[model samples]
Target: MAGSRTKGSDTLRAAQMYYLQDLTMDAIARELRVSRSTVSRLLSTARETGLVQVQIRSPMDSAPELERAIRAKYRVDVHVVPVADSVNEVEVMERVCLQAARTIGPLVDSNAIIGVAWGATISAVSRHLTRKITHGSVIVQLNGAGNTQTTGITYASEIMRRFGNAYGARVEQFPVPAFFDQAETKKLMWRERSVLRILGLQERMTMAIFGVGSVDADVPSHVYSGGYLDEVDIDSLAASAVVGDVATVFFRADGSDAGIVLNERSSGPELALLRGVRRRICVVSGESKLNGLRGALAAGLATDLILDEATARSLVESDGAAEDAVGGFLPLDTASGR
Candidate 1:
């Protein structure tokens, strides 16, 4: 019994130095005063005998209950960012973005194709991405940015550029209009060979990152306030009972996004197409996005969500969430002008 216990202690020390301290096999052998072959056997035996343990724990600050509740309520993965009660709303948003980047960075791989949609929340998250060297990965724009008032390229391009730079991925831009005046014009343009190439890349996307565009979010969705929509557009959306949009494709409170007249002219991919993506990460900030987030979830748009704790609690604790099994439709006040 004494000899067996001494062997176990030796195994642990060898693992600590060889694995934990980044020591080479030869170096470990020298420190342990054993042959290199012996060190190899010990390391192998340590793992095989269950003497070396490895665990991946949740973040210390994670809200496991909120994560559990949101997962139970929505049936999707939830990452709740830790935002102190003292931090301002903007800082809260930035922290959410940081966590989102951290979550997404590991999922990227060499030669993977990712689709990205530009918006305030997504833009914020993109800028803080974890630097990586994922060669052959392509980041394709999911929607056009150009509007009548301004060329949308500068803003959206900057956002895409930041993502590309961080991941060392190639970028494919969509330089078409955000919304065409006539639906026929969009249909005609989409068939062009040059446009088809970008569309093809969009089709092959393995992962997509976007924000649920809310008309009432604390950080007002850029597409709504970015001169992409006119008074008539706003009026039409409201009259049609539209709640919010994802990638400029508007959906209702009940998650119906198809056959809407405004959708025909929008350049964003339809919700049906987005549903097919393997990993769809939706990063949201303020509680004012409750309706929009609910709408996206109703359509089965997001596979992962990262947001602040207050918003997560509000979502999981809202009224009628259990009955419908759709979303948390609580009323929240969101300030603007960031």
Candidate 2:
């Protein structure tokens, strides 16, 4: 028994060096003081003994054709919420958020640090979140929610509170405007050590949950309709060909963020930073948000998507004949890459 265990240990070490550390078989043979063929045999022994295993991810339980198309097109894990076409906007939103809650709820576990972006859709998500027993988890506000009329605590705090309570985790409330009155003010605030602490937490985020905001949605995004932007803001977006935003950082349909001066004043993390999070779960409701969702996918913003079937169908539809023949499975025009 002891001899067999030692042999297995050597095999595992050799396999690790060759496969994981990318060492040449010659090097492994040299280090193990064995012939090249002997090194290969040990590596093969590791596989035969079940020391190495490969798992091919089975498809998730979701809309088969739609999910496959989305996975192929955007390379995102998609959950399509089937709803009747006649469902009212309010009912549709509730259903979508319920799916969001169920999808995100189980992911809450030990030591998870989740970043949350606030908005009408997020507000709906908070309400639908399922309580779970977790410890050392935290929900941090991704962006400052204060507008000119209020301090933002009443709203953004409430949202975080729900998530915190749901997961039995800590909550960190960001107290700042959704958009600063001046870009310089935001720059200066970022310099403060206290502010830097929160930014640090963001860097360590394991997961992020957010809603895509669009100006055209029938169920209006709070930021677009809630006095967060003025005539100048609207004009700037139009002038720059902006479509929608994630965490208030606006982007065009092409998912390019360059030269949009409004981003300087926006309090949200840059798309690059948001993309750094391991799992980004986005909840979307309306067809009006299609351009924004396309931009988000193009920017590599989401790893998981929770959306209604109607919206999913709209997103998959394309004008190309090949795409049509493929059942709208072609890559989104705005997508960065599959």
lDDT minimum window of 10 residues, candidate 2: 49-58
Q: What is model 2's C-alpha RMSD?
A: 12.3
- Residue 188 of model 2 has an lDDT of 99
Task: Residues 227-290, candidate 2: write the lDDT tens digits.
Answer: 8899998999989988889988898876888999999999899998998999999999977788
TM-score of decoy 2: 0.78
lDDT of 2 at 236: 92
Those runs of model 2 whose alpha carbons end farther than 4 Å from true positions after fitting are: 1-62, 319-338
TM-score of each: 0.79, 0.78
Q: What does the lDDT come to for candidate 2?
A: 0.84
lDDT of 1 by residue, 1-338 (tens): 32344555667778999888999989887877777887788787666444453334466644788888778756689888767778877888898987788778767888988999999999999877756667799999999999999889999999999889988999999999889999999999999999999999988889999999988877789998898989998888988888888999999876786567889999999888898999999998888888888778777788999888888878876634554674443322111100
Runs in model 1 deviating more than 4 A are 1-62, 319-338
Return the top candidate by TM-score. 1
